[model samples]
Target chain A: MATAADITHIACVVYPGYDALDLAGALEPLTMLSSNVPFQFYVVGPSLEPVTTKVNASVVKTVSPSFGQSIAPTHTYDNPPEKIDFLIIPGGMMFLDPIERQQPTIDFVKKTYPKVKYVLSVCTGSVILAQAGILDGKRATSNKACWAWVMENCPNVNWVAKARWVVDGNVWTTSGVAAGMDGMFAWITQIYGEAAATVAANVIEYDRHTDASWDPFSDAWRTTDPDHGKSVQPKFTE
Target chain B: MATAADITHIACVVYPGYDALDLAGALEPLTMLSSNVPFQFYVVGPSLEPVTTKVNASVVKTVSPSFGQSIAPTHTYDNPPEKIDFLIIPGGMMFLDPIERQQPTIDFVKKTYPKVKYVLSVCTGSVILAQAGILDGKRATSNKACWAWVMENCPNVNWVAKARWVVDGNVWTTSGVAAGMDGMFAWITQIYGEAAATVAANVIEYDRHTDASWDPFSDAWRTTDPDHGKSVQPKFTE
Candidate 1:
């Protein structure tokens, strides 16, 4: 059993229009991990200001060197510290913009990945990685919603589908918001062993269904139908 | 089906030691709601400044305006111009402290309850409501882990057990963090009807068991304990 102190550094990226769950799902386990282990987490953004979520409820606070603020495991902290041991990128609506324009985020990712062994992404975060040329030929997945967009636009990448997670050596990616937890669990399992990961998932009552090694690199990726027309509320309510 | 503009106003409270799920769970449904419907959602704290979550996530870019920020929801640009149509008080680690201070939250709840038709609380947020004297002798439930605390500290409340959600008259409360989704679903069910709520819940893939009208005052609440910690996980390392 690992105590909370084992997780010393984790850095998360936040940008405007970020999906709340992608970040939250990745965090739930970490918060539990912190209770049993001692670690420092950071929410790094472009500026030392608040980044509004897509839903507008939760905000990711910036952590500047001069202004110190304390946010609990389940909350967002102000500007995070610069150095980190593990870095995670949770996707949102604006995840795939050209990295050239998103200099701050790309610079942060590029600078941190060489040092951090466990680098991860959720949903379209893989798109950002793709733009960064990090997953140029590696297998990965994003928000299944962006399946077509990624396949057509980012040809250098081998996009996986139906797979909850895609791991090629050290780099990892998840399918969507909910799947981020599964991906992170897999990462935790790799480092701490299965028992610890299972215990962590059990504590949060999360059920890991999709297989970790199942890569969707074939027809399986194309055969699935999109989750469109799922909204029941009439488009034009009478 | 709903456009971003369909929502007239939405506000989620931020305070110290607030439960992440209590906020995220409720926001999830509303997030989905916004995707389908047009609406404006805002995160408002007791003050206009940034409020940190219990999990150390800071919600930033917030304007901490007072109730007097605007007399009419239509007039206010920072927050709801008039009475908030939908308001959620997320359960946080800092519930009793606010009550003891008789801070703005207490006055806000008491003064606004008469106008706000739907007043929602997730997990221990109900404790805040109870402390505000709104749930006095009223059947409600807090986080199952904190049931004893709620009962012992807030004697005016009629604490219920073995129930995931409890609703009496206009007030709604949930058992724990995740159960906040159930409360939101039920609330959506009332506003849009079961067909809409059912469709919305299915879209989000929420595994909710209880329904509205499963009042905490009834014996049905005593049938089983969902939080008995029966959570299990895979032990295999492969």
Candidate 2:
């Protein structure tokens, strides 16, 4: 059974080189849930200005719109909803502007993590979380293409090598670009029950990756560098 | 091999209640392909103003951001590029503002279809193409959740019941929201090469649904209304 009253305001953080696609998968399911659940989500950036998003980590991170899609933000980190039940952070910044250059957004995540009911990181988004000292001891997963880089950068965090997504208490982390959808659905199933998740997935014709351990990218792409967008693809046995 | 000069400019149309999610799946592969292929995609609208996007057609079309995500457009129909190599139309208008009310966009599609090298429609975007008199006597597919309504409205189109996507010459039409990704990848394979498509899919960690006729949503969701976002889900056994 799902209770709408407890968790209502959801804030999705958008940043330079943010992968809007990572959030889209979760948004589709959440949007359907909002109908009956009354939960509302908004895009939040460092400022209210428009931000261009990218996910092709292999390519050079150019500010040009030709590289990605531009999105408008309704809320900023300095001025967000009074109560945020869920906070979602997407990856791409690490590949573009490195963790050290992303101080403001990182600081915001650190400060707000304690207040939010739950937090989710997609791909290298977990690296930002790890930098913020949030996933210090938590078992999390990240983009497999840059497995060594992520592990090397975050030594304190227990990075799971094989997982479509990981759930360690209130924190949820996913692998690569598309795995965020599987994680979000799994999170939704846990919070709103299996029925709600099923309906959300079916409505969008999304084949939900039910098993969390159903990940082969970590093993297959362990040696592959994130710079090589051209690689052999791994399939999920649905 | 995909030549860099052939089809370079792609225009993605975004409208009221447009599903950015549908485009996200397509863009991921296309973005990767753009590296060497030189094909660039841009978001376009009826006007320069920001447009809110939605895919949960079950909900009422609200202009408010609470109901959907807002995306900024780089170009408009009245003033578009000198040449558009590929035209990508996304669905959501048919579910929100009816085709008759979407005169500007519908007219744009009708006028641009013949000029472009190739045209692609995602989900109910096919319905828009059908409304523009482009799908007449052509094989196509649409959102299975609203199959009856689409069929009733567009009687001339040869709608396939069990197809992930349908390609008739230069025009490609997909099944539902997420099916567009599968279709776009297939289209990529056809235009570029199997190797390029495979790399793009793998880079994004997207499991490519290769079969053209591997569509179960059409059969399973024949009776489900678009309004009913909750229903039984269909899956593809990998």
The numbered model that scores best in TM-score is 2
CA displacement after TM-score superposition, residue B12 of candidate 2 (Å): 0.1
* Candidate 1 lDDT over residue span B1-238, tens digit each: 3222333565655555565556766876666555445455555556555455533223311211110001001111234336466667877544234445434555566666676556789877887788778998788877654444566678888777656678787788876665677778877766666766654454333445455444332231222344322431112112
Pairs in clash, predicted candidate 2: none
For A1-238, candidate 2 gives per-residue lDDT tens digits of 2244568888888877777678776677777676576667778888887777854354453323475777788888899777888889888636544567667778889988999888998888898899999999999988876676787789999888888899887899999888888888998888888988876676577777899998767556753345433452222110
Estimate, for each residue in B1-238, the C-alpha lDDT of model 2 and write its tens digit. Answer: 2243568788888887777777777677777676566556677788878877753344453322375678888889888777888889877636544567567888888988888888899988898899899999999988876676677789999988778899987889988878888999998888877987876665566776899988766656753345333453322110
A127 Cα displacement, candidate 1 (Å): 1.5
- Stretches of candidate 1 off by over 4 Å are A1-6, A54-80, A95-103, A189-238, B1-7, B54-81, B95-103, B193-238
Model 1, A147-206: lDDT tens digits are 666565568998765677898867889876666777888777767668767555543435
Predicted model with the maximum DockQ: 2
DockQ score of the complex predicted as candidate 1: 0.11
Q: Each candidate's chain A: what TM-score?
A: 0.74, 0.87
**Per-candidate TM vs. native?**
0.72, 0.89
Model 2: residues with Cα > 4 Å off, grouped in runs? A1-4, A54-65, A223-238, B1-4, B54-65, B223-238
Whole-model alpha-carbon lDDT for candidate 1: 0.58
